[model samples]
Target: MATSGDETTAVRGTFGFNAPAEVVFGVLTDPDRATRWLPVGVTAEPAPGGRLLVRGGGHRAEYDVDIDPDRLEVRWRPATGTGPHGSARVGDAPAGGSEVSAEVRAPLDEDRLRRLLGETVTHLRRDVEDNFNAG
Candidate 1:
């Protein structure tokens, strides 16, 4: 679910996995696993200025990848102008699953922003769950 504030919008999704935090974290950090959940043709360099691009259907998103172990943040900039910003945090969840929370800030209206945030969270949750089950 997503929570909207005055200045920031956050969407948090949790999945209970049949694995430990370290195991889940490893999957989240692995590039091959990331591709499984992230949009198609998505590539992450896991460094500053590293490209994080996603393409699906007719829509595409590009951002700079910034990684900090348990946290991953992306600043989406499709054009030379200012762009939307987003971040994802991975933490230990009760039971055996890992919890991931994502927040995005764009120049879009409230409804559009909410929908985008929700979709992003859903995609990520499904991807993580799929990887966890496959492993």
Candidate 2:
């Protein structure tokens, strides 16, 4: 993913959940499941060219879906900032679970980038854990 203004800065995070690949994929692709763990006020069509909106706690994020059976990628541009492009990929984990990875790019210095990436990874991990446990 490339930042809005700086193409050189890239932030990436990967998380693994103890769920089957299809199950994890379903949770990611299904709007209801997505909202239950990710954000609020969500609406998604789960198809190509469809729009996905997530809003809550005075924060809203919108993205266009570019989906496939094995992957659901979105380019998110938020409402209140210089939004960077975002994409998430779900696949088989190395051990016996599913893994999801997301990348976001923004104009942040090296230290900020590291912190942001860490936070993103933690957030994704918690979300995926919650989704998996809720099933």
The Cα local distance difference test for each model comes to: 0.55, 0.59
Q: Candidate 2 on 1-135: residue-level lDDT in tens?
A: 334344446767676778766766666666554545442332333333455665544645566555677454444544344544566777787667877787766555656666755655554456666766887
Give the TM-scores of the predictions, in the order they appear: 0.60, 0.58
TM-score of 2: 0.58
**Per-residue lDDT of candidate 1, residues 13-82 (tens digit):** 4444445556556665555455565544444433335555545545556655556764533234443444
Error of 1 at 49 (Å): 6.2
Q: What is the overall TM-score of model 1 with all chains considered together?
A: 0.60
Best by TM-score: 1
Candidate 1: deviation at residue 94, Å?
0.8
